[model samples]
Target: MAVLQVLTTSVAVALLWVVVESIRRLFFHPISHIPGPRLAALTWWYEFYYDVVLPGKYIFKIQELHLEYGPILRITPDEIHINDVGFLDTVYTGLRDKYEYPLRALRVPGGVGATADAKLHKLRREALVPFFSKRNVLSLQHLVTEKVNQLSEIVASHAKEESQINLSDLFFAFSNEVRGEISGIMKVQSSGTDGKSDRNPTEKEAVYESVLLNESLPPQERTLTRLEQEGALLALAGTESPSLSLSIIFYHLLANPSILDRLRTQLETVPVDASWTQLEKLPYLMAVIEEGNRLSFGVTARIGRRAYEELIFTPSSYANTPGTGTPNTEKSYKIPARTPLSISTLSAHTAESVFPDPFTFDPERWLGESGRERKRFQMAFTKGSRKCLGIELSNAELCLVIAALVRSFEMTLYETDARDVSFEHDYQIAMPKMGSQGVRATVKFRV
Candidate 1:
């Protein structure tokens, strides 16, 4: 009888707590006034259903939620997702600390991308800045060209035999090998795709020197464990986005002969082996790259940030944008200090107001004076203090590889469609649908 009485009391207490907490969340929470589904505001299970159970569908669902609710949505009990390109600067600005809940998903707390505190992220980013600078990436361009040459030779061999190749896998391998070589710029000798290191990397970087000798950094920041974490993040960041973007660019070039012909004509303006710096001058090539990056949606996950100070959002006067953030922007939203906020790449890229007919692979949109206005809304590498560090390296790789492949080969898509390259699942970076044979093609030497 005593055991039964104890069980009854515990059950009663649990129910009471749930009821009280739900009431407080629905009414008494500081952001209870923000508009969204009551279920989303009450529990994180709603997001878990979309992102986890549905396998990274939360970002898409959030866009749907914006149509019913206003521009500012209390996506979670603690987070706000604003779907406006015009409000990009406000959400990802100075002194913005990353939201801890989502950073946990990255599981690389020591890496610069996963650093939460703005000050610490700045410190970590500064240490590695020299290696990724425009000048440094330019110096390393030869290493990239060498890799591209090897890849083209492989393609030539495949073409000679009239065999199809998985360009996605090839591009992915090229990125890995090139990145291993580029690490040499930092004096860190990492083995290429084969994962066989001839010599141990000497301590040349301060972070390596400090961590190896146990001399600097606080305990939490400078452990061998955190060093491994940073390495893992770098390996991923260097490989995935660039490979995906390259595959997307090639797929589009093959599908549209007019685009390929135009780009090839531009390529002819320079030497047969023009450098990336020279290729960068081609307006059409640059525009094609911009369009591909948009479709690839670099870093597809919705990365959220919380500001140290209050932020005010007034939507751009872009009116009546169906299936976008502009549908409900009659009023300004005053977000309190330390609120978790984000302008996801999905929303930013597909904002019909910014990039009309956003789905179409239209390079013309990025061509003239209008293109300059459209540049602010291009968040493929994101914005603010935390923008992608490998931007220069990625650009160099894309320019060189795409130029070499297009100028050299006449390739046709083999059993591939838009679904093969389109963003279907988001595993941090975008993944296409299940059973995706990443961007297959049959190639032959250009006549």
Candidate 2:
């Protein structure tokens, strides 16, 4: 009798799943119009399974789908994946003032990362903007330079000792140090020694990493993954991080050494004392960093107005796009109220219309007159009042780190084949698998 009861319950659950899927298919014919794997049409489980279980392979899946189905595809009943910048423009900033999507939680025991309130998101963005403001970033130039110089010395010492310097480790340390300074946290020693400086608690590190490192905890234990996911949902009603973008920058630099050389030369022109005011002069470094962000968009999704009360137009907006008109007029979608919309930044970044040869790491694409045209389509940092508050700071950090390293050391891949420099990325905020052929580079002292 007990065995029969268990079987009956299992069968009932399976039947319910089929019914739910069938109902979803009936109402979601719009999703059916877009092409994807058959499994995706019948249910979202196929995509979710791969997303959660095989994140490393999932990156290519979207790209493959684009090759097969043009620019737009559907991931679930409500989610649409667009590889066309024009459509993204219409959706992300066009017809909708806001949309809805799953929020991310990167840590547990606390729900600081998840919340869907737009007002709260605005408050948070406003609060954090000062840290990444042009003035603040300029003020931190000395600190950035100091850290970069210190890093160079450490790398040089390792090179002299015939020790292989793990670029991945160094980059993390570098970013951590920079993050610490920006956030007013304690210094992070990269040499992994010197007990003099007190470091912030390990938890104060990238709050976004909570998901990547905290997947195993039971529900009762309040895992980092749960915390981060929940926190993201509440805070921004979305999710994103800088890990993948950083790793990809290094990967591409190694793959295309010429590009790195060009960037180094460009950085050479910027005087160490030059303020952020002179940022406009360093086009090449800016281009490289932009291309890096395009290729490895940190925050892959966002939610904004699903429908709007009015309409407005402003194609020149990059970040901070709320200026287009009434808070929701920038879009055309005439979104009905309370609609849930999700925009995929990866798709937008790779849109052929927005970026010619979207797959190539061409900094020139961003350096020419056509660069203005590209700007009209660029949304990696996103646009609107909700644009990434860290944009300016992140750019400065990238410039400082790249320029400093190139000036002090000759960076080369430790692996014989540049392709070997690759790592498996598990995509919840641009993270690479912790240990797969990570960034091992030999930094020779240039002096």
What TM-score against the true fold does each predicted structure earn?
0.91, 0.69
**Which lDDT value does model 1 have at 318?**
50
Q: In candidate 2, what are the lDDT values of residues 311-401, reduced to their tens digit?
A: 2222222212121221211322232244454446655666554564666778888878898677765666666665665666567767666
Residues forming the 10-long window of minimal summed lDDT in candidate 2: 320-329
Report the CA-based lDDT of candidate 2 relative to the real structure.
0.54
The alpha-carbon RMSD values of the candidates against the true structure, listed in the order shown, are 4.3, 9.6
Candidate 1, residues 149-222, lDDT tens digits: the string is 99999999999987899999999998884333334323432322332244234312333433433433566765
- Report the lDDT of model 1 for residue 41: 92
